[model samples]
Target: MSAPADATASRVPAGPMARFFRRLGEGRDNSLGLLAILIVLVVVLSFVSPYFLTATNLLNIGRGIAIVGIVAVGETIVIIAGGFDLSVGSVMAASGMIAGFLVTHGAPLPAAFAAALAVGALVGFINGAIISYARINPLIATLATLAIIRGLGYVISGGRELVISDEAFLTFGVGQVFGVPYIVILLVATFAVFAWLMPRTLFGRYAYAIGSSAKAAQRAGVPVSRWRIVYYVTCGLLSALAGLVFVARTGNAQPSAALGIELDVITAVILGGTSLTGGRGRLWGTFIGLLLLGVVNNGLILVGVPAFWQQVVKGTILLVAVLYDELRRNRVEEA
Candidate 1:
């Protein structure tokens, strides 16, 4: 009997270990697989280009990805909530133009910055209102807004770029903290905040609920429409922030800047494992996805891949990611 008790006691410890391994496997299924892919890409690129592993080159790539990474956070949130915002690129243009134009015209930096954020909020409000109240489809609404907002940017800047000479403003783009670029710091902070928010907040839970089933969420006392509006507004705010950062980094705001960036942002988010149909994803995954794209772009240039082929490679990746997501979704449904 004592021997039997000893065996049972040993099995008790094994049970916890088994549970731990099971949870680890689940996390791997969700994100660790993507992490593994990123590591593989990094190793391959390091072998393909001597400069790819250099600190300077790595820092440059981080700075290059900063803007897109910031926007990707917003895109990830919108996707998680089952909405789309094709106008983000346009919003970046318009918001940057507003801030740059203001500062060039002697507006205080604070006021100009505030104005840019306000512009983003206003646009987001309109997007949310139209979708929530007018019942317009998000795709159609944002697509129309994309053109309208781009046009507005041109009108505001008279089809010219706005140059800002403020030293303080320039610092936002170029400054470093503890050897890390400010833009990279911003990207990391944004990711950190959202990562915490998504997994630990009531807002996140409600957003996921709405995305999974709006009617069901409503029945469960979630204000689906309101939360959706919040999501769109949040997306708009981040897009504006990205615009401001872009302007600071480049020292000018072109009315046509950020063209086609939406595609990149969307691709990164989707590739990070966010379901396009909504209701599942982690910000950490999105962060890795952003890094993967950044590394790929940097690696291609370092390897002497022609500019034209770069686009082709990116397009192929996007297509593959989308197909994979669709097939995965189908399997889940069938199961």
Candidate 2:
């Protein structure tokens, strides 16, 4: 009787509580996989080029990725809400031009910066309103805005580059904090804020819930329209910030600056495992994704890969990431 009881106890499956904790550990392991990739890339690149492992080269790569990483955080938010934005690059150009023109006209940096950010928010508001209120698809709306904004950028600059002469503004671009680039610090701060918002806040959970299933979210009273608007607004504000950073780094704002940055931002977000179909993503994942791309680009230069070929490689990587995202989504649905 004692043997039978012992055997029966052993045969029983582990409790749901144990299984739950095990699954949580597995999820953590999945998260670590991203870090592992970053480590491997760093190791491989260091082997490929002696210059690649230098402190300056590493800092340069971080600075190089800052703009895209910042922009991609906003993109990650928008994408998690089940929408796509094609106007971010154009918005960056236009907003920076607004600031540049202001400085050209003798406006103070603070006032000009405020105006530029306000314009970006307004553009984002229009996008959100049109998508939610007018019921237009995000892709179509933003695509149209992309051209309109790009044209506006050209008109504002009069097809010329506005050279910023403000020493203070330029310093924001090249400055360092505790021996680390200011731009990298800014990127880190932005990532931390968004990470907290997306995973630890009520609004953030609602955003993800709505994207996961609009009908279900509606039934749950998630206020889908309101959150969507907030998402786009945040996107716009950050895009303007990114534009300013770009201008600081380049010391000029041209109509052509950030011409294809939206694609890169989107690509990084997708490669980070954010579902384009909506509702799933982590800010940290997007952070790593941007860094990965930055590392790749830097590695290419160190290895003497030509600029022309870099574009091709970038496109190929984007294609693969998108395809992988779609397949991953399909697998989740099937399961």
Candidate number with greatest TM-score: 1
The lDDT values for all models are 0.88, 0.86
**Structural similarity to truth (TM-score) of each candidate:** 0.92, 0.90
TM-score between model 2 and native = 0.90
Candidate 1 per-residue C-alpha lDDT over 182-300 given as tens digits, one digit per residue, 9 for 90 to 100: 99999999999988999799778877887788889999998888888899999999999999999999999998999999878988998888889998877888888888889889988
Cα-lDDT of candidate 2: 0.86
Instruction: Give the deviation of candidate 1 from the true structure as CA RMSD.
Output: 4.4
Model 2 misplacement above 4 A: 1-31
Candidate 1 whole-model C-alpha lDDT, 0 to 1: 0.88
What tens digits encode model 2's per-residue C-alpha lDDT throughout 1-335?
99999999889898977665654444422234556678999999989888898899989999989999988988999989898888899889988999888988899999989988997898888899999899999999999998999998777668999999999889889998789988999999999988988878976898799889978998987888888888898899999999999999999989898988977898788878788888888888888888888998999998899999998988888898788677666766676
lDDT of 2 at 190: 98
